[model samples]
Target: MDWKGRRQSGNIEDRRGVSPRGGNPFGRGGMRLPSGGMRVSGMSFKTIVFLGVIFLVLKLIGIDPLQILGADPGGVASEQSSPSSPRITEARKDEMTQFVATVLAETEDVWNGIMKSQGLEYPEPTLVLFSGAVRSACGNASAATGPFYCPGDQKLYIDLSFYDELAQRFHASGDFAQAYVLAHEVGHHVQNLIGVLPKFNQMRSSMSQSEVNKMSIRVELQADCFAGIWGHFTAQKGLLESGDLEEALNAAQQIGDDTLQRRTQGYVVPESFNHGTSAQRKEWFARGFDSGRLAACDTFNNPV
Candidate 1:
């Protein structure tokens, strides 16, 4: 991908070493247990209620709930302190981190230029690198939740291990595929900045679950198009190598909800398809890449 020796974004927040375990009173820990000291593996409802009562009592007394729970409000607290040494188990893994930062920087550059041309400002979103589990302003998520962009914090969270899964499990290999993943999440951040998500959320309140899911498909497909818009810029700059576009297109096809569902459950459910079919994903991405104009990427205005 020719990412080496490129500028890396300084917006990276490395939380790889922080254990998802240990009770964090401040609600900032990577691995957050439920209220009242509950654990993921096992936690009784009775205990949850008991802890809830205690928490309520503490709140009623005007006490800092986290202070009573023995958690440091400042940062992740652990007896085996030191924010885990920067450990990259493999050379490839280290390179992947560099690649992520580089791609983020490139996105910033591309979006900045595009926004500036339109008389708008582009505020860069922070990229958070974590492992296992992490907490976000939106919610806590395990690595299994995949990469996501949190509108609440204007940050993108990723567990690089997902790249391995993308290659091995989803059969979506190549550096460009990995780049597309980050770009897609960044597209969500862009949507958040422009108020698409807020409008969707407002509209969703009046819709049924199935109806909301239908709208969600438009949202996701738009992000795919946005990713392709980034690809268009990169290609125009001659940064894309041969077969790079194919890698991204293949990735879009591979991760479609229909494809995943068929592979897992041996069937497909249209009503449950929130991210569109493989054809839709590939089409929208191609649409954006072909026409770099943001107006062409409006899935909501046009049919998906």
Candidate 2:
């Protein structure tokens, strides 16, 4: 992982200090309203009827319901403000921020080159950095949900603190491990760009939950393979150390759905697994790394 003097991406949106009212950004707790507002406990049958009638009339007239309610549509309606959490120092946070930016720039370079070779334009996705919670087109997410890619927005959301948890709880330490997580999310963005996400979404209504979960495992494993493709390019650029590959492979194994479930819940549930097992993830990633070909990542057709 020789990332010194690498170019940093300007696509990072830092929203670490912003807070939401009511509940945490991840939508766990109930939002408390300000004074003079309708309280859930105070609402009676008559009040509910009156509000229902008002909403119906507003809908009939094509009026924006939120505006009719005299609410600040653009402002945070949750808690006012809280003291900032002091997990990482400002200097360390900045360093991690730059590291992510550099990795994103590398992914952009590799994907753009690969896409151009296939006569397709590659649209780079933004990486958003936040703390505590963040609002996304997909919905509100707390740091607890971990890093995720929102296909609707074509952006990656991450909280750097999760890296700490990855190291401490999952024992997946090393800078390369962190890079793999980012690369995996970027892989989802690639799927979105190449139409895989739309096809999967279309099948959701007809597929059972277990079937959909199997599809999700395929999707995740494909991302792992894409991350390995990135690693191949990075290695070609002479950026990899001797043990860097092992670090990444270890990370891939450590975060497998089965491994993670067993660690958290003391049991493994195969049908509920969205991400592939340790061996499948490592194998697909190694396939991509060895072949360095996008076609090698056809997890949908391969047995998992």
Candidate 3:
């Protein structure tokens, strides 16, 4: 994955330091409002007492002290505030962000071309970079959920820290492995755009748990296949090195639900598997890599 000097996506929203609701009203710390309207959180004790006397004097005159406070009297003027979050000085040293962005850019190029050929418009999805927790149209999610695609928002949420976990915990390390993660999430966006996700959701109610899990496996495998399709273009574009494909294959093998379950619980349960087994993942990825056509990546029609 030679991602250097690649174009970064402009769709990235840098909401890193900002709160979801815009800005915290409470100055740096908890705010205490004076009877009239002044915020007294950071004020001196004497100032607070002076304001309290003025509030009492006003109240004695049959006037509501809250009227002096800002807009809504019932509403708290300040919620709470904290120190600004640490800046991403170290983000410069981390190659993963650049790699992921490049991968996303590549997907944009490939999908845009593919959609154009089919007489459809391709809308590029935003990729959100966050640490720890993030809020999405899907819901609040911790990094433990790994990378996910929110169809409602048409964005991809990834915690790059997961790459460290992929390397340290799953022993899957390589630039291509990380690229596969982004590609798979982008694949979900593909599903959303193509109406596969809605169709799958409609079938969930009528299907048994095991059957649904099987469908999920199919969905995941297709994403893996889509990742490989991207890999095909990457290789053709001279963006991939000799061992890149193997790195992605190893990552696919490492994160298979069966492998993860066995590693965690000392047993493998087929009925509980959402993603496919290691062998199935490798096979589907290989199918897409061998043939770049979208038809070859259709896991829904083929029995797994």
lDDT ranking from best candidate downward: 1, 2, 3
Worst 10 residues of 3 by lDDT: 29-38
**TM-scores for every predicted model:** 0.78, 0.78, 0.76
Best by lDDT: 1
lDDT of 1 by residue, 1-304 (tens): 6677889999999998675543321232121101111112446899999989998998898997888778876654633343443342456678888999999998999899888998989999999898777777766776766787877788888888888888887888999999999999889888887888878877877899899879888989999999999999989878888899999999999888888788778999988987888899999999989998899999988988
- Model 1: lDDT of residue 173: 95
Candidate 1 lDDT score relative to the true structure: 0.80
| Model 3: lDDT of residue 72 | 54
Off by over 4 Å in 3: 17-94
CA-lDDT, candidates in order:
0.80, 0.79, 0.74
> How does candidate 3 fare on TM-score?
0.76
For model 3 the local lDDT of residue 139 reads 62
Runs of candidate 1 with Cα error greater than 4 angstroms are 20-88
lDDT: worst 10-residue window of model 1: 29-38
lDDT of 2 at 217: 84
lDDT of 1 at 78: 38
